[model samples]
Target: MQAVRGVLAVFVLALVGIVSGGKMISDFPKLSVQQMCELMPADTSFLRPHTCNYWVRCPANNTSLEEGTCAAGLNYNKDLGRCTMAANVDCPYSKDSISTTDNLCANETDGTFLADNSSNDCKGYILCKARRENKSNCPNNLIFNPTTRSCVYTNQYRCPVNGAKTKSPACLSLPNNTRLANDEHCEKYYICVDDILYERECSDQSAYDVVLGRCVSALNATCYSTAKLPPPENTFCTSMGKPKVGYFADDESCSHYYICGDTVNGKHDTNPQHLQCGQGLYFDYEKLSCRERLNVRCTLDRCADTSLTYVNVLGDCQAYARCSGGATVGSGRCPADYYFDERSQGCTPVNHNYVACAA
Candidate 1:
């Protein structure tokens, strides 16, 4: 029917998140929306993979899809096609290579490599194993093939997004521990435990006070800045600085949570009033209400530039942190009889994979 629907065109990259004459871009142009609309085949829109601020149009012939947002503070810049602002919006879902703190496979003298088509995309491909750095792709939608290395079929491969040096996660579909604010590296921040989305930083490195979401003193962090904006429309409480009244959580859904009252003058209702959690139940930020669904696990958070991994410290048991690729670096304490132990990285009295920091 339209060539078997073109499978949503796979990942139609034209390349351009804005940078026109200065021309430095370095590949930047992603557009996955991964898999939504289930199967549209209508007027065709598709630009919601990782996120620019939400979208999924599709009308003309209509197969549904609808769901769009991009205005307050703005973002959605599919290369000037719309919304734009927040420096010019780069975010297409982050990670287009550039991680190297040494060890992206040392020098690779042993098996399946792939990233050098300037850097990435041929559907990813890193492997390695012992030295670490997994980063693989090309499963079915196929695209690897660095001269018969593997994966096939494609109008020359797709996936490539770097949202200005990574920092787009406020932990989608929030409601776990939920604490966020890394508008784009104001020293780093983001938690959501149980819902996932780790990526923290700023123990003394300072700067990330998006109105008390934590970390301070980069001259008092007005929201520091390494420049490269556009990853903040946070909207769960707008980065939640003045929020206090009662329950809060739900940036997209965890069955739902959010409710504030009073403080009409000091300003702290970053869009309040949200509820829902009783049909099979869900919301449970420390038993604030609703339950079940394995006691509410939710889900969201990502890391992969090579991702080493290890997290827990949002509420603290003794402490734990370490994530290498995608950043979080250093953090671990556990002394009194030992604690933090993911097998071997230090701190251990036995208790490995983390059970909410053991606290």
Candidate 2:
């Protein structure tokens, strides 16, 4: 009975031990090597499992955990299901996990890391980034004005008028004394002269008036005379109104006038000059001359006597005559001892006493 009781007690104790071991295992959680390393203190012994290898380490420790090692197990925590350490441990908060937007070395309050946001290192870095991005913050010194953009070493510059690269000493020291020219770098400066830009010179007299202090043409009256005078006879003289008779002046030299002449017979002469007919009127070639036209007679008479019995003597009325009484006359009648003649009714023989002539 004593032996059996001892056996039963032993069984109970073994079962209790097994139950406690299982409960302990159940309370603990698995942890990765990284988690276990993070849990180690800055100053602590890192021991190997079952080999008795131990080493003192600090937060600076960069060692990796051996697989299936007790050192890993020693750092594990069942309650939190992770690892913990007392000192020299790299805490989760100390790890660098900044976003892409943030500067690696920038403090939270300030956005830059150099003096006045300028540093050779920073500049080099920015330039590298710019090159990588295939861009430029400033190109040709003209596209970007550095002064306005808060960059160093750049200002506005313009080309000079005369295209000179260097200015005279007077230009540099005095106001408005500079030349109207540019420097090799195409930079221009204002010249000083009486508080204004000094651009005039002695050689520019033709282009500028020293007395008037203004620009003017060089070909003024002072530099040239009026057109050459015309000849005396050809000139327009008020005294010679009628172009001097035989010597007629050209259209440009003559002045217009009028002349009066005689009227011949009942008609005024239509010619410019009244020359006689019997003297034979002819054109005078020596000077401009004129003459009158001769008078001519008509074949028919315009006036006739209607009371007399007669026929028109002339076919075109060039002349007229009266008819006699008691003649062989009808509507247009003739008088006695006169016959009605178709050509003329002047008294004639009854039988062939008169003959008509071809007028």
**TM-scores of the models, in the given order?**
0.18, 0.11
* Whole-model lDDT values for every prediction: 0.47, 0.26
Give the Cα error of residue 221 in candidate 2, in Å.
Answer: 88
Error of 1 at 206 (Å): 9.8
Q: Model 2, 151-175: lDDT tens per residue?
A: 2222332212232232221222111
What is the C-alpha lDDT profile of model 1 across 164-265, one tens digit per residue? 332212222222454445333556655545323445677643656644556666665555233222343324553445546778657466567887765666
Model 2, poorest ten-residue lDDT window?
A: 181-190
